[model samples]
Target: MKNKYYLLICLLLSSILGGCDARWDQVLRVKKVQPIEKIDLQGIGAEQMLPVQFPGKSALLIASKNKGVLLLDSNGDHLVSAPGRVETLAIQSLSQGSLLVAAYDELSAEVKLYKLKGGIDRKPVLQYLGGRDEISPQSALCFYQNNDRTHLFTIGDDGLGHEYLVSPGPSTWELVEIRPLYFGEQVNACAVAPFNEKLLFSQPPIGIISMNADAEKDEERKLLMQADQLGEDFGGLWIDHSGNYLWLTADARLQGYELKNLQEGSDQTIYIDSNYYPASVGVIGKNIVVLDEEVDSLLYFEYEPLNPPEHPDLQLVDEFIPRIPASAQTQPVSSAGDAADDPAIWVNRLHPEQSLILGTDKKYGLNIYGLSGQLVQQFAVGRVNNVDISEIQHPTYSAIAAASNRSTPGIDLFAIEKSGKVEYLGLQKLNMKDPYGLCLYYMDSRLSVWVSDKEGELHQLDIHLGQDARNWQLKHVSRLPVEGQVEGCVVDAQNGQLFYGEEDRGIWKLDLHRYSAGMGKPKLVAEVNTKSLVADVEGLALYLHEDSGYLVASSQGNNSYALFSRSGTEFIGNFRVDMNRELGIDASSETDGLAVTGANLGTEFPMGLLVVQDGRNRMPSGRQNFKLVSWQKIENILNLSSATAN
Candidate 1:
């Protein structure tokens, strides 16, 4: 009986110890003592801090739980004061001695906007700017500024958060809703790393979580440190001056995490005497200042981030690629989430300057944009994925548009009048299991459209027009069998050459004459090699030179366009479309279908233009849209100006 009781007691002890992580009690034992200094705020209140600098002023912007804001020097001397009853503060730093301030108003659970101006030995002044009528909770809020654009993030206890684009107005600042993000649990503290666009939030009982701060990016939360891993209690969180270390504070301790690559975690724990309990933390110059309310003082620690960010080879390769800014972008598609896919250019022969851009919203219909990137027309056709427009030498119509309709499981054909008018010719039911890619090929006065299913089945159909303007017909031509899936295709009318992308395989070229005679099969023209053409080759467009031109294909895997010589079918070069700060367009990625025209269409497009589908729409992030790049810029970058000069 004594042995049984002893065994049961041992089992109970093991279960309790297992349930309660022993590391939770190890924080005090492992951390080493560090030298520290303090500021006595015994009566004033919170030292919740942020660092700011101007032309002639540089100090820590201190926040008080009740007494407003104060500017404290490195030695803890209060230099400036602004009256308000705010517990938290966020700053959006700007140039010319101006910075945006967000002070949390507890009564309303919202934040009031203020613009601070102080420089050239002048006293800093804060202005009461009008803010939005509705807002998220400011209890856990921070500002993320990138490329001179400021964004406000507010997270609530319910794990719901709102992200806003902060736009300054005449006497106010506009808060535009970009997206609503979820944190999934109660948040203890939060911080933002602008350099990598990462949002780190501490969710107690679970530990720290980091996610992409950009609404246009993947917003999946990744656990950086588990609750058991954070040996100490988490009180405050802040990103260090280098934007490399994500520092978390607790009772007498600090944990710095090198978050260059979140997947490869590297961190260090610095534990101090347990006499301090930090409630606020931030960076001032190269030192760390922690607000410890237990003694009503701010503790300053002389510390620097330990290690440099780890950059893998893939990251280096990404930085090595040259970026080309966009000059203009079309109005976003009406639908969202992978809706916009392909674009087709419809050149008005009568007024070539007024050529229109046709884009497909795979979720809804079609959209047409003008040269200046304005919405001209929108059609509610159902789920058209890939679209192509070509000059049709028909009696009733000058041009026609063809697309693969996933909703109807058929082909949608439309006619374009000489005056830029689009009339629906209706859908042509086909024998396709799942039609995915469609392209129009106009050769020798004959108009044909090539359509492909997701399973690599390809079919060509000749389009015929009746005497009536809206009456159009499609007759099945010959079928071309491919090995795998295909999407992008283009035809060289002058050379009777047809090029199609087999996605994972590569680009294939088929001779129209040989295929017509049933002699040979489509041969691989370009393999989806990592050197140039990445897998899932998409959106093929031919730039017609004097005689032989260049074949531009979308290297979908890499967000680049690869150029191949039409004469030898050899890869020449590739270029990526990058962000344009002036135009507020983000870099193009995961491109779908693209269309290029070599004909000089007036002054704006003197050397024609290239319209490619922007897979991800960002920078004041909205829905997806098509980006237009000048052929001149592409030629100049690739040195194709001399090659295509003719």
Candidate 2:
């Protein structure tokens, strides 16, 4: 009985530990660190402090009860001021030496915007641009940029967050729109790190929040802090200029983390050995300033230079185009944890409006959906990951669909009947360990199915059509070894050519006849480069028109698709499938398998449809599902309406 009670106690403790961040160790990298230097505020008590950037200089902006807005240099020497006691301040640098400043005052319940212009010998001028009355004092205020849009993010003590679109033209500045973040309790601290532009917030003793500050990308928040150790006083957030380090202040502890290596469980933790209840931390050129909560004076410590600044993932906004909205989405998979893997679109020739989409539930079975994205049928067969379909001139079947069945360790075939319904045919066994991605190709009287395995093996088989349905069988035709794991495969049946992704490597081209012959090897048409593809390239599909088309690959690392010309495999462009708020459909992320056809399927999909498996189904968050996009929407956005012309 004693042992049983002890086991229960151990289980309870483990469960609590699992919800918190990793264990904290003694101060690593920086040792014997404490605030040795003190900044004599000279009887000025500061309520808040932040490091602000000017045209050619930077200074610490402090809010004092006596002084309105005090700008102090590294030596704590006062530079300038915007009079009238301010509680919070948020500023972002604009083009042409104009600083868009946002200030809020608690006494008068006023929030104002000013255009700050500074010169070497002149007092920084704050040109009043706009003002608004607030109901209550906001907890924190910050600015963030997403693409060309700028927004102001603020959190209140009510645990509610407000995001407002801030438009600062040459002459005017005002909040144009508002987007709300309804976070329940304990969310107070918020800071936008400069280098990565990641929005970091702390929920006191709860956890640390890290998410994309950009309104354009996935705003999914991630926790990266050891909450149990952070105490309830963990709130203040600061980012050093020209660095990627995120400085955090909690009660008697102060630590900075290089977020890039933090996820890798690296010990880039910079800490202070001594205790200090800091109200705010100001990171300057060569010193760190912390406002002492108990005293009128400020404390300063000499710190080592922070991590150098690198480009942010938000840089994709400039490098890659914005995601077009998804037109429709299918019901989520019944099973969870990466169940919905790939999708194959079946265009009904008899009834063009009655097209169907066959998607794989790698954890359960297969799901069939109509053009409206409603599940028409579901088959609890086995784990089928990736799928494709091809028109076949068989004696019995009208069209054939095939998927890589990890359960069978081979290919699972299906028949697309004229009623726009899918029927399970049979599974062809493969000797490979884990058969992963599969695509079908049919020309003349020959129908071929290609399957790739995780252990770097590629195989091809020919299906022999029998008059009876049960007599259908597969004959192994070719087997070839690859360099690395491959998942996405596509075949251009019109040209008798094959294209496949080598996962981490790049996309390759091979002649269909050279599968087993080893006479001539596949040519690396496109190497996995930063400009075109980011690795573990998951999906590949061809949008063929006449004799030329485009090869689309799921650049899963960045949640975008890279397009290449089919004739020469030249990198055309990259695009993302963004969210459609009106239709209530979320964007695609970590896309596993996608299928596209350039054939118009009636008025609903007049330019055909592009179906992609949305690995992270969010917006109205649910299980994983497939997002259907209009092919014409992609072509127009990429300006390929004429580019795909023969």
Candidate 3:
């Protein structure tokens, strides 16, 4: 009986231990994965735009067309709604739990202020009117605090901006000062930040305006790095926590200015290319949040308060070929081969060396090529003009095309396999006047696709697809009106700068951040002298060698490319392309499309390859074919061959 009892005890112990062992096994096999939660806010229609988080809170203020403010928490939960039919609204909260909302009526030409009890959506307890009770609030309103006191400022349509103090005692306020903001021209938006006893206000499209609380006398704002002089638009502005460093986003670049001495302006201005058009700017923690509305994505960078922030100075180390080769040429296997035009190369970020070259041919439809320049696959997409590819979190790839038919007049998105197989995704009818160039960039932490109309307008689109690619949503972000006619656009991935090329004019740079401010204008970097280089400059590329300090720009008409020193605005030599004798050379004219071949040619080919359009002018047949030539041969023509010849 005792032996039997011992056996039974052992069995029970084994069962308990076994269960524990199984639990341990399960724990070991468990994988910790981050959960993605998406909160949807309804009632907010397409007209409500520019939803921004309120500083130091979980609430967000949205611009609405319904003439009211839509308030919500950070988690997309609706809090309350403030009703007003004001043309424009600006919100700012003070340390004393008081919120100020500035509303402007363009049609009525009046500026009204509403002091809310709770927040932006709370009921208004006080109101103030500006400008003859008839003048509209034509300028952007900004809020600033000095010594526990808050001030509200605005620029009028007459180019004059005024400041008022909100006395905290009751609901009473005082018109402290009314100063004229002279920007040499018209002012679009004004921003003010506290600097000791005085305030720093920026009247965009001109310079920085400074004023003190005590109006002993008024002084004209000094030109702190003139916007027009820099040849770019004022994109966005931000003041650091310590109020020592001022960040400005100019066309195709971001600049850091030291505010140590207000009288001396910024001690140093460091410029960086943002690889995309920076439309707006906000602060998230210590990172500078830049919004590129063109691509509908947000870029984050660590903010440095030093006189000159330490940044990557990408220079052209060598003009040699990259080790990677272009994807193999693809042939149309589909029946709709006669409808494609331009082919764009999309490199996989996860696999830098791996890329997909997509082309559009009228007869072949859309063709995909491998990195080796070999045809991988082909499919029909009606008639395609341009193609773009984007990588998402999922394991799938999304391809977009600007196509047209008898009924449709815009671009569409398609689902593509990593292996180059194409499937019809969805069509986006932009109803644009003339859509030509299509580019994609990540903005606001989302993938945004930009389609440019040759008439100088850009349409920002958001592409969303339901499960199984059944439906897609394409929402327009903003329609930007450009100055000169734009032909092609390239984003500087290293710095977030956007380079826009024109046909007769040179390249224009847009500080995506500043553009988002809805103020200022685009600055011209290098004006194209049609009489010298190329009559019509179109394509642009920044070739940064691993350790070198040079950048090269290719011009199609001059049949040559120019090199510039990376540090300053000095011209190096120019390299001519001898396409007159090449196979696909057309005597009529050279056109757009330029790319650098990423392959090492040890002996014969040497410094990679330069690809361009071989103007053949044949209409269905005149669509120029792309030509590839060795960069080494071109360098020899530029008079640098003997110096670096191996």
Candidate 4:
């Protein structure tokens, strides 16, 4: 009996430890610490804040909202002031002990550079350097000099960061051609490490991120560390003079982080007054100062690194499960011969919440579903392999829809009613054999359709609406020859560019206008030789923002999605969809087609939605179905440019 009891106790202990591990894997551990409020800034308010020191005295440089920059001592005694109200400010030290201060105004989106001459004993003279440039005034600016050139990096409210180079000749600055790095998080504060050009940016909820200052590639902005979620109480962030620690003010506490293993957890924390929130924080030598608007005082505290006990056996796990992410499975479409092959999202302009998902049932036709995965409409048009949707304004009716008809070698036209139902209009017969994939392009007050086949033949047809809004006619515009079997294709209406994936070789791009006119040559965007992109690059989709975008391709051979710059096809990163145990859906593999939309689609997909055909929906047992992945999850995992992060 005693032996039985011992066995039972061991089992219970094992279960408890397993449960703890499961919970730990779901969320990251955030060490919370409080700092004591020390000194205050008796300035106007915090529009911009910077910490400065000269010769033998330390001062706080406060750029008041509409009052300008005030240089004040530790006790709030005003020493000097620069009269120019600005949105943000950046300071750089010159060789001769002179200071260059650049102030930006949001209302004008202009930056004015000023040179300050002299010391704290006398009121310094401010000289305009004639260095003016346009930038997002709402962003925080940081200046760093490299190779005799001054570069100003801005963290924008849109989460799209930009960098500008100041010319040594005139006072001119030019925007660098670096691909936009989307943080997907509002950067509350930022700092640069002069040692290796490393950048540290802080955001609420997730903590701080360190990326290379000259991050021209996506992999360079790797995740470093995540701090406690301060919610709405997030404050400013600063790196110490030694570049070994990062300081942050959040939840009324001034926190310091040591840089040994940044990807694991924060190193130290100091608590301050709970009643006052630290609006801005800066560190000078061994003293940390904070600005509290509620108390109308500047608080300073002596800083010291705290030594915390280490948990040698404790293992830290990232919130994401490596490259796999959880996803939701749509209701299955029952048809054989690779039935569920492709999908398209149709936004309901009336009730965006009621947006419908249109997927291809290759053996049958098109299947439409509600946001809840309930099949609402199914059109038996005939062996449709791929489907794409675009809004076309007709005189009598509002829009018309089109799909490639693989069974009969033609294109099927339809009209999409506001009620999420598609009405078949007519069919435009094509001379091509075995239509495989199709996409629609609408721009310049015209609509055109592109279709590809198994033999690598591509055709562009300019669709014209006849007198009766229901009648449609296709005008053969151009035909292009490709190397291998082709299927996936998409057009960037904004830039008039065409991108298509050649299953066995790689992805290619060409000018849409010139391609439609049969006058342009195709350029290889990415090839299968790349380790990140396997052979059989199946589906291609474009994620477009107002100023930037990314091209996502389904690397079918590897079961991962590869991203590239939409402008020049620059390689970004790759990710895969994994099983969501709670949702009872399996990981996607051997995907054939995918579609993405930036439009808001209710709560489940407030940011956007990515629908991909899951070749093995349940894996080893169930039928194929489409999977629904929250675009926000992909953004956080890949740090893609997303307004949702903002």
Candidate 5:
């Protein structure tokens, strides 16, 4: 009996160790790793495959170069087959339990679409839809669903992509509004982000590019990953509904990227055979399936959730930074103390040719400049920390600008003329200590100014322009808590929301116009301690559109900017403004203030502009100055659009 018990214990110990070894191999970058499952396709001669998920079941659509398009259930049982030797296969879900399949013919190099008919009980039938003769003969096609309309995307050998909106006709599918996208690379695979509606594509020799689905020009697309990090050859691309991207390389490796921030997260070797070459990849349920044409087999990998790296994967590490051409540079303003802190751009409605930039020389006062960066006017109104402009309905002046007076516990006011000139209107004393950050907002016929102290106390002061326009009435309306040193603040007047940044903490959102004498409780927008945001969140700016908006916060500790959705709790991504070689200006770091707007300021800022305070402008030595960036450049890098929230 003792010998039998010893034998049982040995068997159990061996089983436990073997299980650990299997899991351990999966985590490492080893050459010989066993897949969870594999399906033999040697006899089928499958060239490419795509995963399809319907209301009740999951299946695989295989494109056989020799045969036709074959539909197989998850169990590998053949269900349906459509005539036409295919080189590439793509499947997409349609409204009302319908399905769409796109196939590229191997011999003719023609692209055609078919609608899946029938239910789970019977073999589905493929109804002939439509064909595009204008498409490049040998190309790969993908599908994207935006709102309720479906779009077909194809990348040709010439590196140009064509997008067609699918419109269902009486008996077939119609393609309309063919939009061409010049990716400038021989892209073979493409995927659409389920969360942000961004198009992700791959360029052979390992490059990934992202663009908004509605972008009409090539300049709007940004290369997310270059060929330096990835191997020389790139394969299939897939993005799941959870915003996780899977990419296959010719070297038989699978890479996982986070779609929310466009950061690389996990990597694994697909097959052990040296000759194994991955032709395509797809996500079926929780498994990643890779098609190896060399071995004529499908290798499966279980999806693994990886923790994001300590350092953000997506960062500005290359020298190809988009330069916002500086038409001219302003002559440094001489001050007794440090000057040139923040700037606000105001467009001249009467003379659109004379738009001006209002910059605050901290030690002196406010200095106004023309679009060419030439000094137009300067006011000697004490030391001011921040400045902002707003249109005020006053009898004398139609618009006014305000700045936080750093030398005293007050805020200075100025009248702005349409021709870019400013008149000193004296300072208004506030009931706060050491006012630091300031911004002006108008809503519902009420003009208000928000001022924050160095200790994180935020006070909202209502401004009532006097009849004579020389003096202004200030009413202390509300006070909000920020805990640490708080500085930057901006208001979304359309949403009645207020956002402020705590230097050591993160950002806070509160009810702005509804705040009744500090009665409203502020909600934490993001927390630095959570690692999503770096400590000392410095500047906060809002880029509002017709349907959606973005809240950009300066993550000072990492020298990157964190972008969050204005309507949702999603952290879109983070970006850094690196050195612009073309303009000979260094990157912005330790940013104290930033401002963004969607309104066109001038020809230089036709789309909009982003002005960032460069805390350390290291050309020859460090000097503080505001760097103007075209908002369109930011929109391209981040792949943001009005439909991004959808």
Candidate 6:
């Protein structure tokens, strides 16, 4: 009888352990990564492809890991890969059939350059630009042709920008007539395009300057636009094939101007709503391709004709289903529930219904919902502060949620699956005061997460989730002192940097990997003088339009937003969201939640879509209870001189 009892006990134990193993398996399954859905426009390439500019006759090129530059033909059938690896730092195609590539040399401080013929077989062009030397090959090189000669212009770390004239003398090439362009201020990058044997140089926080090919005498420079007030990093510039129109990326927007009118101080600007941080921009035929390195997505937008092609009155062409549900039904499945706040979409393969939607409720628990708006899983996290999703690996995605109580303060980890199963991964125990915002990114090829607190401090947490997402762990990496309440955070992986916005202190910059390695410290890049723009700032976005860059921040007070150049030193203009005027409501409207979408100009919903929170009528009163605005109307509002006049 004792032996029989032992056998039964063993069977029961095995059953319980098997159940736990199954639960763990489901949680790790959440890591499966998936590709985002693509929206197609006429004359646009696949959404997954990064659009790059090639030389004449060739419209666009896409970067490949193994192959060099893959040229995209008209039929999309002839795929040709160029020979060299496309450097992420600097890649520019010169008019004289040469491509300039920039990469880090043996010493991290010096940037090396290589000149390639037909996108392959690179030859070392320029070696190291010493620390004291003003120019570093790391700067973005602009190619322009004047009087049958090509010129390369770039700004270095020393805040001095130079222009080099390339003279090809039948046998060898030489860089001559190098002259100083911009001084005192750092030139992030410059864009050059030819117009009637003259080159147009665009320096942000300021407008465009035209330089002619005169070796001995200084060329006459003309101001195309006034940008000093717009904050120094306004955006990049793009000139069309005919050099008729100039495009600028400013404050989460794309503005186009007529080239001739720009020279005469009669430039007409049209705004396109682009939400992603635009890093680089290119013109492919009539379509505009923008790369947002932060979001890891490429956008293709076409120019709309002065007159409508088919339908002039059309506003919206098509509307895709909201990846995140407008409202989630709150109910307790196995644990507890409360009102949901801050819903974020996770697009990955493991939990595919778009994976998961994470939010917080006052009931001290983190809520997880499936794509169908059903509560499949719940975690007992204490007062969820903020949540961020990072794509780790297949069958093992990680969700970092900051949870803290008055007594215990730390971040909780949850490994979940599409089936609503959840597992409690360990937490990074930090004695922080009040952790509020969290942002995650891959820096230096390592999975790192950053958390910001109310006391104006940012902390980095290193997450170690094995390739098989089943096991996960977290370790405290580093912490940096900051100012104001850190609200919004983003990581520029391409540049290996991290940015956070202070409620009243403006924007702060930190070297992610360098800080993680305990080598460098965080520094202040720009301060949004609260006395100037707005009182309370919440959200921050760095939009890199082609070579130009813009830093956009949200001012919660008076429902307005401010634009600055990429460096965050200069102010461009202040744009107010008159919810009452736009929605025809009262002054009681409060704006929250902003997102930018990219669409072709000629399409029905060209420009893109802007999602905002409407407070006119909250739940249990209004029909939809929220407002989703189109980008076209927002563009019209932003472009209005009176809206930004204050």
Scored by TM-score, the top model is 1
lDDT of each: 0.74, 0.74, 0.49, 0.69, 0.68, 0.47
lDDT of 2 by residue, 343-451 (tens): 9988887788788899999999889998888999998879888888988665455688888888878778789777676788887787878988888888646888888
The residue-level lDDT of candidate 3 at 349 comes to 41
Candidate with better TM-score, 4 vs 6: 4
* Tens digit of per-residue lDDT, candidate 4, span 1-646: 7546544433433432221122221222222223344444444766556777565556677766645766666677776775655656777777666677766655456676666655656565566665444555445777766434466767677776665554333344333332245776567677776655667777766766677664321236655655544445564766554555666776755655555455654444444546767767777666667777665567766554454234222221111123544556678887854678888888887798888888888888888888778888888888888888887664344456678888898988877776767777867789988888888879878888889977888887898877775677889987888878888889888888888889988888888777556678899878886467888889888776566677888988667888788853577778878655445555687889999887778888877788888776442235668888887788878777542211
Q: Each candidate's TM vs. the true structure?
A: 0.79, 0.66, 0.40, 0.49, 0.49, 0.38
Higher-TM-score candidate of 3 and 4: 4
lDDT tens digits, residues 52-106, model 6?
4344444344433333334454334334544333322334555566555433221
Q: List CA RMSD, all candidates.
A: 6.9, 11.2, 29.6, 19.4, 15.0, 32.0
Candidate 3, residues 43-155, lDDT tens digits: the string is 34312222334334434444343535555554555556655444345556645665676656454555555554454444324344232243535545666653345556666
List runs of model 2 lying over 4 Å from the truth. Answer: 1-144, 148-188, 201-235, 238-278, 281-318, 394-397, 514-518, 642-646
Q: How many backbone clashes does candidate 6 have?
A: 23
C-alpha displacement of 540 in model 5, angstroms? 1.6
Once fitted onto the true fold, the runs of candidate 6 whose alpha carbons sit more than 4 angstroms away are 1-343, 348-357, 367-380, 396-408, 415-428, 467-470, 513-526, 529-533, 541-552, 563-646
Candidate 5's C-alpha runs over 4 A off are 1-339, 394-396, 517-519, 529-532, 642-646
Worst 10 residues of 4 by lDDT: 17-26
| Whole-model lDDT, model 4 | 0.69
Winner on lDDT (1 vs 3): 1
Worst 10 residues of 1 by lDDT: 15-24
Error of 4 at 339 (Å): 1.4
